[model samples]
Target: MEKETTRIEAFSDGVFAIAITLLVLELHVPLIEETGGGNSLLKKLVAQWPSFLAFCLSFFSIFIMWVNHHKIFKQIYRRNTPLMFANGLILFLATCVSYPTALLSSYYHTASAHVAVAIYTALFVCINLAFNLLWWIASQDRQLLRPEITDEGIKRIKRNYLYGIPVHTLAFILSFVAPTAALFLCVALWIYWAYTSGKLDLKSK
Candidate 1:
């Protein structure tokens, strides 16, 4: 237990860092030839808005997850095979976020925008599901959590996961008919998660 949780956290941090870093690959400046000339530089830069927007959205999503991951570690003090595997599920989906970000940037203005947004929302659906599983497994036994975490703290965490799934699923459903709305919901969900997770800090309870 001494080095167990610490090692898991360190490894999880690395995965999150890599995923966040990969998101930047989807963003690039307009090349000299592509800009046509210095006079047209602003126009070309403006055209890359989709990439810029998607990068920010994806960056913040991963950043918030990283923050909440730290918050979760503050409660979890033990590790088991199931818990580690559940956490790994989260890391896997997080690493894959860059792919959908790339998809959205490439297809945001095309007829395929709905498909791209659906894929992005779908990834989020899986992410929220993985989080729920991780929390559920860790909270099932006090042996896995810190001495300070109470039953209410566990409930709060569970409540957060419960809210996450249906909302993300709704966004996923909306993607087919309203990609822009679905995209907007993703932004809102991150903000909601940040707020809820901040208040649900288990160590404090």
Candidate 2:
């Protein structure tokens, strides 16, 4: 079980790495001709603000997810069929991140900006729910957790993962009318996860 879980973690890391790397593909070089109308290269690069912002947000989002995933698995000593499927769900969603990121880069300045950002925001919602489900499944079987894990620790982790669902859902709803504000909410959530997730007490044996 230990080796199997370890392999899954390694595979998941590869997926996250690929997804983060793919984000850079949307960042195009500002061509000289594209900036031919008396526009400087710096100005053209600056005009691609949406691309840059999307890349940064997606990159950090994937990076932080990988961190929390590794932490979750640390306490999972035994595994089950449902646990495997839940983890697979997360990896699948991780790969899908690049698509919405590309959408943002392509349409964020146009009338479709709301749609693009909404999709991007919605993806975050899905990813968070997947993680919440994964942890819930893992916790269902106490035997799956490390021997040292306390009941309080389990409850704490559950509460922490639950925080994402409603927050992301709110952002998703706001995406339709106030996409920029929705994106700002995503940034805030990312910051929240970065600081709070590491505080989980689920330590491995």
Candidate 3:
């Protein structure tokens, strides 16, 4: 099980790396000729602020998810088919982020902005649900977790994972009424997770 866990983690890491790397592809260089001159190129680049913002938000969200995934696996001593599939679901949603992120950037301040932002937020909600399911499966019966992992620790982590769902759901809900605010909340959530890394840290006595 340990060997299998290692392989799964390795594969997951590869997926995360690929997903994060793909975000940069959405940021294209402005063509000087199309812009009329090099001076106007600067303005074109500046106009891409939405792209840059979306890239940063998605990049950090994936980064935080990767970190939490790594932490969860550290406590896992075994894996099963269900857990593997759940993890795969999480990765699939994460990889899908690039597309919605591109949409959000392209449709920013347009009629379609709300749809794009809602889609992006909805993807995150699914991703968070996947994480919660994966954790629940592994922590059940205490069969897959390391012996040193305390029940308190498991509960804490579960609470942390569970909290993400509604926050993201709220963001998705707000996306319809206020897209920019929804995006800001999403970014803020990721920032909160990044800064609260210690909350997920499990230590063995």
Show model 1 residue runs off by greater than 4 Å: 1-3, 203-205
The lowest-lDDT stretch of 10 consecutive residues in candidate 3 is 1-10
Error at 25, model 2, angstroms: 0.7
Please report the TM-score between candidate 3 and the true structure.
0.96
**lDDT per residue (tens digit) for residues 1-205 in model 1:** 4535999999999999999999998888888878788669999878888899899999999999998888888889899999999999999999999999999999998999999999999999999899889989998878988877778888888887788788989999999999999989988989998888776665554
**lDDT by residue for model 3 (75-155), tens:** 888889999999999999888999998998899868989999999999999999999999999998587888788989999
* Overall lDDT per candidate, in order of appearance: 0.89, 0.88, 0.89
Write out the backbone clash pairs for model 2: none
* Model 3, position 114: C-alpha lDDT score: 92
Each prediction's total of clashing residue pairs, residues at least 3 apart in sequence or on different chains, is 0, 0, 0
> Which portions of model 3 miss their true places by more than 4 Å?
1-4
